[model samples]
Target: MNEAKIFSYGSIPRKGDRAKAYLYFKEWVGRFFEFDGARKEDDVVRVVLLASLNNGYVEGSAKLLDLCGQTVRNHLRYQDPSSFLQVNHELVDRMKRLGALSKPLTLAIDWHDEMYYGDPEAEGVAGTRRRRGSHYAYRFATASVLLDGERLTLAATPIVNEPVIDHVKKLLTQVSELGVKVKLLLFDRGYYSVDLIRYLNSLEAAVCNTAAVSHKGVEGRRG
Candidate 1:
């Protein structure tokens, strides 16, 4: 295992509760991520952990990790896509281990658009008419299990000109691959369509979706 060396605390109080909490979080992430090749897995995890804790950028991560900004950027730039996918799958499995998929699944499916202001040549960039932040954006369709007082994201896929129904089908297929039995599915008004309802019915999952009401006096409708 090419694990990266754990960060040294130096003069930081090792016995402090905050230090222990950080260690616990790092160890939990380490359990899910396993990098291949000569890359230091520890360093990779450290960079990600720092970025997540800070401004979610390499520069902030480098500041916390005490490494050069380019070094942090290179660590991410050189990552193999296949390895990243493996890590994602492993993380999903870890979520299951934490009882995220223990009961019959009731998923909330939705689309998230991230405003993008970068170069036009970037891949996966698309135009969005839904918001004013940026005309161009990246979209992702996510399926999350509705847990007790929280939602656990089960799967997310990039959306690039794919039909919404087809993307929902693919998301469901990925959730099924995780061995979760779908009991119900909830979606916003944007996903209200007879075809989508029929598809969920075909899978024996009850569908609850907000209908697009063109008139008043219609409420609490279920299909």
Candidate 2:
């Protein structure tokens, strides 16, 4: 039998604990996902879970599980991108239940630019400041909560010609719906737009700006 490995420390583990943990995640994901029976639905779930655990791409994960990477691609061919949003909500719910989010959290929102060398006219490509030898890039805004010494992602969305305020609003709305309270909002200088700053001032929480300008009484936090 294959050895079951759970990421617990030197703590004691009960018999069948590893199997139970594996089954728990499988069942949890199945609750939010569906696939055709002919899709080898269980294998689909296993592939996804393995890839996520490895924090690697599908091909790398498939090689470890002796699975053909094509299975993942075939199943995703007709999948709706937005439908997976619920899965994140479920994950947040689990963390909340475990008291990981018992208090207000400090959130850091930042822009991530991935340089795109392809034709700028291609869909989902946005014009960005010259960097990495490319003026055209794919931009993504990520919202993460400062937890312990690490950042746990709250939301991530591609910036495909959307206004910054609208994108921030959408991210905050998603967090609010999941019952998260904000202690402070941190912003990098990339979000130093007048409209965004004005919107942040309207919020009830303290603001930490990494840039020169900010609302009155809000201190600039330099990293």
Candidate 3:
């Protein structure tokens, strides 16, 4: 008997396959967002998604998406803030539909400090102290859901000289508008304050936080 012959072939994904996939993705994104700009919607979505997936740099996204860097930069540079907020609101709605707000959920609020080496007088710049010590930084307060071993950011607001309690109240109000009932809030020591606790209590949400060491020491002395 003649020996049986066997053949194997390796198939690489075609560029057309990638293009088709991107088209489908763009269609889904379009269902939730509508870009109103000089750049084509497809191109805008491609650049924004690609840039997000690639460390948020236009040059890297352009190289990966086979577009000119300057073109990607222009699209981003000219993107309207209102359009971006509309898109974000749509995403948040979708997230709520995914059962993110179906029930009372534990929420975590914190401040993210981004170091800025630029001039201290720059607009939107504020002084913040981090592990690297005091520096001019842009601070943003973020509220996130702690669900099923994952944290999903729900809202973020710039914190330029705003009190932490006020920022938290604003975030809670925005989250409430999304129909989410916050069951509890977890905060860091930096956010520990009687006024903040009272505010959260007024919202009928349980609150937990790490007591600042200095506060603890003062209380100990008073005792």
Candidate 4:
């Protein structure tokens, strides 16, 4: 049998003890394995036992097992995530791996804007009328959840107009270089234009958007 050896030393009694220790080590290796990125905490000691009967090692088995599988499972998820999921399923795994590696998610793209208030009192005191109050109107571009279910601020910019498609595409290209994939988008109707829709489709981005009625296509130009 193919076996790997590990040496452990301590003040021990006899040759028989060494044999028993090897048997225990071999049995442990044969029976179980740890996942590559999983972790267990001491918080569950009241409900679960983590100490080895032979040795006083303290660790949660299930958590270790899960971590062992995390790396492979995340890789698989990134390769082929089901489209119906609202969040970028693949992105989560990548984030987990990044966390395991002690890296942080760095923001990319020019995300302009400071607040997302529709009330007039909240508008900036002195500002450009084209965008008026905030840095820029959130609806002017395509928007997606950078990190969802968290308290989101309006300081982030969205995919605003078809005219800026090249700019947005370049930003996405930069993000992909960091090994994270952008898959889903969320935005408002004002960002809608034929070109923008086509661009989003080209990126294979499943988008959630508010619909805009184009005046050019309706009766009397459908105003």
What lDDT score belongs to each candidate, Candidate 1 first?
Answer: 0.64, 0.69, 0.61, 0.35
RMSD of each: 7.3, 6.9, 11.0, 20.3
Q: Give TM-scores for every candidate, taking all chains together and pairing residue i with residue i.
A: 0.66, 0.69, 0.64, 0.28
- Evaluated at residue 8, the lDDT of candidate 3 is 14
Tens-digit per-residue lDDT, 155-178, candidate 1:
778888777888888888888787
By summed lDDT, the worst window of 10 consecutive residues in model 3 runs over: 1-10
Lowest summed lDDT window (length 10), candidate 4: 214-223
Pitting candidate 1 against candidate 2, the one with the higher TM-score is 2
Q: Write the per-residue lDDT of candidate 2 for residues 145-200, one digit (tens) a residue.
A: 87776567888878887778887888777777888877667677656667886776
- Which digits, one per residue and each the tens of the lDDT, describe model 3 over residues 1-223? 1111111111325555445544444555554444454556566678766665433566677677787777656655655666655655665676676666687777777777667766889888887654355477777787788777666677778888877777877877767666666666667667777887666556532323311112222211101
- Point out the worst 10-residue segment of candidate 2 by lDDT: 214-223
Per-model clash counts, in order, read 1, 0, 0, 13
Model 1 spans > 4 angstroms off: 1-25, 28-41, 50-70, 91-100, 130-132, 204-223
- Which one is best on lDDT? 2
